[model samples]
Target: MAIAKFAGGWAFNSKAMVADAWHSIADLASDILTLATVSVSLKPPSERFPLGFGKIESLGSLGVSSMLLIGGCYMGWESAITLYAHFDPESAHHILEHIGHGHSHSHSHSAADLGIPSLHAAWLAGGTILIKEWLYHATMKVARERKSSVLASNAVHHRVDSLTGIVTLAAILGANALESAAWLDPVGGLLISIMVINAGFGNTVASLYELVDQSIDKEVKSSIRKQAQKALANIRDGHEAEVRDVSGVKSGQNYLVDLELAVPGSWTIDGVKDLEDTVRTQLAAKVRGVRRVRVRFLSRDAPDDKKYAEFIPGSPGALPEEEGSSKQNDELVDGHSDKHKH
Candidate 1:
């Protein structure tokens, strides 16, 4: 409704209106499609589409982004062409005066009249570029929060829109203000196309990165390891135990981690089970981001104590009983041993 009001009240040329209307419709349709895709993706699946359709939602967003990019590029091209036609500035000034003064004037103005203050078609092209940029950021934010690839891709289109706006604005301003450099308009349009292409390429690279299941950052992995270590400490032999693998799966806003632990062979089956349970329970209770934990136990042989025999020898510290006896002591000291020999 607001758009409609703007469209009606603005002193824009017919071509500008058509271009704006097209851009607006495409953006609206993309938004609606994204929402619908998300809903369908979240729906329970049947036999035909067995896998939960969340990924399809992303694909839908990608498709919408592609369309938006194409439309934006086309609009940019059209604006460039309008500038090349060398539209009259007097008509644009007249419309501007009418809009600024808030007066309805009955002057016949063609779409060509919506040109830049000095250049041909600058106003229409520049305005479209600006609008596209605004939409891009808005959509990107939504996509990032939802973790939707499609939305991110669409957002790239908006970035391209912004770049194009810069080119168009510069070109129009240059042509109008400096007649010597009138060729800048078309050159700027070409540059805008290149920028859009570059953005599209970037989106493709990002999508491929996501598809490859890339490893997370070292800092994040280290943090998770620290949390796991902290959680495992509650177990009996957990302090000595070695943690091998920790795999996590996202469930809604939370995460579930499966841990593999290596413990000593001395630990009984029941003891190992208890340790496993302790680790899982402790992690679930103590870890801030951990929603669930599954622990797997593996037995490890304890190091042999015999290897350090020199450091811990086996020997008796007590003297011989016969030598220590009182009778033996008296016989030796008082000549009692001689009487026994005789």
Candidate 2:
């Protein structure tokens, strides 16, 4: 589709069609990137990376973001130049010649390069709209069936493409039909470029946040805490298990959950282990997007336990040594030290 649109746009000298073609090219590149990134990102954790390879998805998204930003900026600049030339053909040639340093050959040869958009270009835009719309619905259907956020996001991307294609089709048809409205094609190109730029910028920020290990939303944390609380309720009542904290960062659609559980000091190590397993299993079963669960148990009565005393065993706050016993021990140590003195 990208190739066909690009060739048709260039042959018919339609700026809007060519800009939309570049958008299609970005989609093609993203599809190729998704193929590799998804495969790697889906791999189970290994000893080398206990958290798995989910960050690969962010890398792929970043790559696509960069491509869109670069391509869209270039298209916007070119379209702006074309739009300017449509208003003042002579003035544009002067500006291009000046930018080209008065060289005989210039990047653009006046407004004539854009030419009159042909009906063929309008046909190409209409076809692109149809194809992209079809792709959007089909991908969305599959995404729903698989419950895959990745596929759903891709479906949304296709929807944007189709909508942009609608604009491209309208602009091309308007330019083809109205002799005085030739600037509409370039205007369409500029609008499409803005959309691409906005998409790229938004995706770039999201990927950056993911890379920085931003925590999941509060709603998810609340859900996790609620689940943990429910799991503990099912355990023995005297254990007094309570959720202390629920926190973690997201990687793609899946996330790792860090669960802090507070239990009575009387609970045995084996009991804590069982609780951990129970919470892990229950969350994995009941939660829709939890990838891993790390459970930490802290004794609720630890502050009152001898093991958690504020003072060390020999500290001043602890039991004091007998004063005479300490002095006699010091004299005995002095005598022994004199005998071994060097």
Candidate 3:
């Protein structure tokens, strides 16, 4: 699509088609990255990567959006330069000479005299729109079925490409129909650039939030809380289990839930462990995309702060440090320190 549109744009001197070609090129790159990331992210967890390779999808989205932003800026710059050159007498005369026409403002040049090529470009753009619209629907179906955000983003990219094709088609048709409306071609290019830039920026920000472990939707958290409470209420033990906190963050297509449960002090350690497993199982069954659950048990008489404290043992203002947290924290802090030093 990019090659065809680019060749047509060059042949017909249609800036809108040129801009659309650039967008198509970016979409090609985005598609490649999307496929690569999705494939890599599907790998099973290993000893080294206990959480699996989920964040790669977010990283790929960030790369794709950045490419889009750069492409849009370049297209906008080219269009602006072309529009500015149109007003310069020397530049306009040079353009006329390049098109094999004399610089006469007579407006009497017929299609045979001016060799109008915009019509053919318009037809090519129309073909592109049909193809891209089909691609969008096909990609969108898989994205929904898999609940994949990266695939959804790619589908949106296809839709945007189709819209750009539509704009290019319109610009070519309008310019061909009106003698004095030649400026519309570049104007259309500029508008498409703006839309592309806006989409890129929005996608970039969303991906960044995901990469940084942004919290999941509030409504989802609420639903999980309600479902978990109901599940806990079904336990026949005399000891009551209360949900202390429920939080979750998205990991690619799934969610990682952290739940704190408060139980009666009289519950035995074995009983507490069983309760945690039951809660985990219940939540996993109730939630749509829960990939993993981390359940923390707190005695009813424990301090409120301790209920939500970091599981790290020996940490100030936190619960007793777990056996391996100090080692993990040391490695984590050292890694960050080295990165900053570099």
Candidate 4:
């Protein structure tokens, strides 16, 4: 699509079509970003990095969105230059004179002379429009199925490309039909440029927000809290305690929940384990994209300044109890050696 549009655009000397071509090229970059991010983010957690590689997807999106913004700005600038040339004969003559063309007169051509678009370019524009729209719908469907924000954003980018193609096609046919109104071609290009820039800016902002770990919806967090409280209450019968806190953060396409639980100090280790497990299970079942849940148990009788006992699945126990036991064993060995020496 990019090659066809670019070649046909130059052949027809249509600024709008060329802008649409550049938009197609930007879409190609977005596709590459989507592929790269999906591949990297699928890796499991490793020894060095325990959270997995989920943030790579957000970073990739940031880079891709930046590219889109730059491309959009460049296209807008080019279209502006073209519009200036179309409106001011003196500017056109200056450009031609610099190019050392045979005829460098200011009044050599008028706006009416540049208005009409060729038949071949118009046909190419129509084909591009159809292709882009089809791609937009297909991509959107897959994005929805996977519940991927990056993919959904790319799908919207494709729709913008298709819209640009539509604008180009209309301007080409309209200008060609209205012989005396040759300025419509550049005007259409300007309009498409603005649309492209706006889309790019919006995408960039969203990607940045994700990269900075922006909070999710209040209602979604509230729902998670409610489900967690209900699940905990069911599991901890007869215990006079309540949930301390329930917080969730977005990690790429999924969520990580930090659930603070308060339970009776008399409960055994096994009982606390069961509580954590039950809360995690309930959250995973109810929440749409909860990837990991870290449950922290606080003793009901312990001081408020005391730390929570964190229970995260998959991490080996490096708890304070194990450290205290190691210290006690060392002291016992030292005392036995001292008694033998005495």
Candidate No. with top lDDT: 2
Order the numbered candidates by lDDT, best leading. Answer: 2, 3, 4, 1
Off by over 4 Å in 1: 1-34, 37-54, 64-164, 180-182, 212-220, 234-237, 246-259, 265-297, 300-342
Measured on C-alpha atoms, candidate 1 has an lDDT of 0.55
Clashes of 4: 1
Report lDDT (Cα) of residue 9, candidate 3.
Answer: 89
Model 2 lDDT, residue 50, Cα: 89
- The residue-by-residue lDDT of candidate 3 on 237-275, one tens digit each, is 723888888887877666888888888878888887767
The alpha-carbon RMSD values of the candidates against the true structure, listed in the order shown, are: 21.3, 8.3, 10.3, 7.7
Candidate lDDT scores, in order, read 0.55, 0.83, 0.80, 0.76
Q: If scored against the real structure, what TM-score would every candidate get? A: 0.47, 0.82, 0.76, 0.75
Backbone clashes, candidate 1: 2
lDDT of model 2 at residue 23?
Answer: 88
Q: In candidate 1, where is summed lDDT lowest over 10 consecutive residues? A: 101-110
Badly placed stretches (over 4 Å) of model 2 are: 97-111, 302-342
Model 3: how far is 17 from its true place, Å?
Answer: 1.2
Clashing pairs in 4: 115-182
Which candidate has the top score in TM-score?
2
